[model samples]
Target: MKKAVFLDRDGVINEVLSSRVKFVNKPSQFYLLEGVGEAISLLNLAHIPTFIVTNQGGVGLGFMKESALHNVHKKMIAELAKYGAHIEDIAYCPHKPTAGCVCRKPEAQMLIDLASAHNIDLSGSIMVGDREPDIEAGKKAGCKTVLIGDESDNFAQANIVFPHLLAAVPWILEELH
Candidate 1:
């Protein structure tokens, strides 16, 4: 089985905007955080198939339509391509927190599905994100976890903490080297 490095969209690969007020209802609101492309490129070079698994509850909340989310992802992919990096797959859970959907982060269905579909070895895989649910999901999926942000009460479960993706890249590579 192959290993993968699962990533979160918002905050991990891109900037996180709650969009609670204005709501990122359109593609124009999506922005890539600096250095994300190079960071992902390193993962690719390391022979790790990188997958993006995110919780896009904005669609279920009526803040944005599903199409908008698709468009944003398309834009994200295009941007990444410009830097010569590509993501292997992208998955998302559109249900809001109240819906208690199983596919959302903190649950491992998405990871499990990907592993089953692609023959990924979950034990060697790692999940990197900027939030608590992302870490939980990785753990539940039996993956190593990395939290890219501050390490307060918000990310107690992460195996390693980094300030950003670039900082995390070396450590990820070292794991294999």
Candidate 2:
């Protein structure tokens, strides 16, 4: 099996919006975070397989249609491609937090399912995120977790913490070596 990197989408790859909707419901609302393209480009150049695993509850909650999510992903991919970055796959749980879905963050089902489908070695993989649930899911998936954001009680569960995803790239590459 090959090692890979899994990333959380909202805050890690794109700017987390502070609006009434609070989610990227449309392509226009999706903006890549600073240095995100460069960071993912670095990983791509290293031939590392990268994936995005996110919890997009807005879809299930009827806030946005699935087609809107696809459009947003298309925008994100197009922007990243300009920097030579490529994502192997993108997976999301479109269920509300209270839906008890097994694919949600804090549950390793998404990662595990992706790992199985792609032949990834979860133990050798790294998961990077900006939220506590992200770290928890990575830990549960047996991946080395990196938290990108302010310190929190659950953030302590990560293998390491960084101010942002760009800052964590070097360490992630180092571990892969």
Best by TM-score: 2
Evaluate candidate 2 by giving its C-alpha RMSD to the native, one decimal. 1.6
TM-score of 2: 0.95
lDDT tens string, model 1, 33-70? 78999998888888889999999888888888899899
Task: Supply the global lDDT for candidate 2.
Answer: 0.91
lDDT of 2 by residue, 1-177 (tens): 999999999989998765532679998888888899999999998989999999999999999998999999999999999888999999999998899989999999989999999999999999998888999999999999999986664444789988888899999999987
What lDDT does candidate 1 reach at residue 34?
A: 81
Runs in model 2 deviating more than 4 A are 18-21, 152-156
Best by lDDT: 2
Model 1, position 176, has a per-residue lDDT of 45
**Worst lDDT window (10 residues) for model 2?**
14-23
